[model samples]
Target: MLTFEIMLEVDENKSLEGNVELVPQLTLDCVIFGFHGSSLKVLLLKWKGTEYYSLPGGTVKQEESLDDAAIRVLKERTGLDKIFLRQFYTFGKVERYDRESIRKKLAHLVNPDLWYKRPISVGYYALVDFEEVFPNPDLLSESCGWWDLSDVPELLFDHNEILEKALHALRLELSFQPVGLNLLPEKFTMPDMMRMYEAILGKKIDPRNFQKKILKSGIVIKLDEVKKGVAHKSPFLYKFDANKYEEVLKEGGLFFI
Candidate 1:
């Protein structure tokens, strides 16, 4: 079994003039997902003068651990800290470097020498409360925004593949782990939670069945409060009891839809 390594070392002070046998570079990319109403959004940055969208990511520093590097990148790009981030996979495929088309796409930034030494990238996926993040584009990007996952446009590099893998991992996690607490608001209604699950699963879930199943799980705590701003009878607000849910998950008693 291949274990994921989060930390990497690179000498930043070393000159690029030397004909080094290997161009060692460690980079961290995060797929930050946010849930807004019925849409699943992802944070993306648009590079200045470029048509492609890229994930908010940065290279690891010589003195920083991979976890530290990921935190630094997230804060620098999106102003989010202490979110639920997990490293799931490392991508080292040889074809990841075959940049014939990518070079043409990013002609302004591509160099033949750099193209020869494709960097291996590690991906981390984080679920964050959308309202808590105050995102700002980095110096390299002209704009940054949360894009609806359903309408994701042409992304740069191998980000498309990376995002696909992240989504797959997220679905697997949902099956066995209670990971949606961070993606939703602190106080949400059953409909809100159902929409989030449907968005993640990319299908329509029967409303009545969804409510019955999730409610019986005992993971959600019904509050005395009711959702405001509704024309009809307000729905009861609920919050995930993370501690209890995790315990159920560990005991393999948590329900999966």
Candidate 2:
């Protein structure tokens, strides 16, 4: 029942002096996923002048609702207001708190004392179009971009564990949800869709069986047109039947792979 409550766009340079109206000891960490061809990518922020990298995160403001804060932060980072965002977990292990690590990683940006207090972070994962996302770094980060999940380096804090938990949550929901619509283009072949599933699940799906199962779900509709200019047989393109997709999502158990 944990909801999204992150604040990635807050200007809180003086919060340590008790000036900013931020919710004490609460933060939001986002694990954004984007698909690029065959790879599942995660968005990360690189701290300036350091080898440290972390998920984009911020402290929640006292005035905004948790859901509102998450929506605003996601829109600020991805430049898309209607993308898929889900709060998967809340991480607050006592061992995960490391004040010195925070001070060391952000020495150049702000006074380390600013984040000395340990926070209970809410984790949210989002699915966005790889091409549509306009990655923007905040004041403390040097660059923001996608990293292939397999190649993700050692992250700051307990972020690696958070990322792993987020992925596990995503895979759990994949069979029952039309999450593909968020990661794929408007028009795509069944093969393209299957590949996306395979990428996330880390396995290849049987083509014939996948097609049959998906078609039976009634979430996608085959179009009259096929992919053009292919050397091999051009497969018919398909699109999500928005109404049917939403209906299936609402019903929940009806749709499965």
Candidate 3:
């Protein structure tokens, strides 16, 4: 997205000649969700001279794949590379551009008349570890940081709608796959995995059923080690048995908890 951040970060003089070279009409918006062991958060970009916020987005280049464009944008905004991003939906509401708030914010980077022609935006979402990400805000943006999914501010355009749909799809995805396996560290306790699931699904999972389902999936293997330093009984540590996980995937590729 060519927000003030792009104008400021890439062009301090407010000129759009170079930025215009980017492909037109097609845009990519990415929703990067993170877990910090307690609260779940989404990465956001706050514009300069305005209180409004937006998901980190960019124009898809003529030569790059849509998937590569999302990866490029994510890396630019977060300094991350090679992270998995899944396309969840495409937004093409004619009335999506009817709002005046985002237009005013983009006035610094795009011509008022030209900016009003809203581009069809593709949506992609990825899960990440909050601690591993380093927030890197581009020029024209005041800050780049995590916003709690529950405490997100009034976002610009149809972004609020996009976030709602992404979260819905993810919750449904969790019912059949171990999507968060990559979000956690290599070794973790059952409680750690349980908490991550609860955060994504937005509900509490019973401890007994939670452990049973995960272990029964045969995707993860229980390690001999256990969590230490906690006051209660120690929880065992575990890791995904890559060989078995892949074998199960080849054998129909389904895991439910």
Name the regions of candidate 1 deviating beyond 4 angstroms: 1-23, 109-112, 255-257
lDDT of 1 at 148: 96
- Please give the TM-score that candidate 1 achieves against the real structure: 0.86
Worst 10 residues of 1 by lDDT: 1-10
Better of 1 and 3 by lDDT: 1
Q: By TM-score, is 2 or 3 better?
A: 2
Say which candidate scores most in lDDT: 2
lDDT of each: 0.77, 0.81, 0.74
In model 1, what is the error at residue 104, expressed in angstroms? Answer: 2.8
Candidate 2's residue-wise lDDT over 197-233, tens digit each?
Answer: 8888888788898899879989899999999986789
RMSD of 1: 7.4
Error of 2 at 72 (Å): 1.4
Number of clashing pairs per prediction, in order: 0, 0, 6
Runs in model 2 deviating more than 4 A are: 1-20, 251-257
Candidate 3: stretches off by over 4 Å? 1-20, 103-111, 175-178, 247-257
What is candidate 1's lDDT per residue for 1-257, written digit by digit as tens?
A: 22323212223333233333322555678899999979899999886667678888777655667888788788776677678888878888777755677656655543434546656888999898999888788755668899999889978878888898998888878856666788998899999998889888888889998888777777899999999997799999999988877877787664444
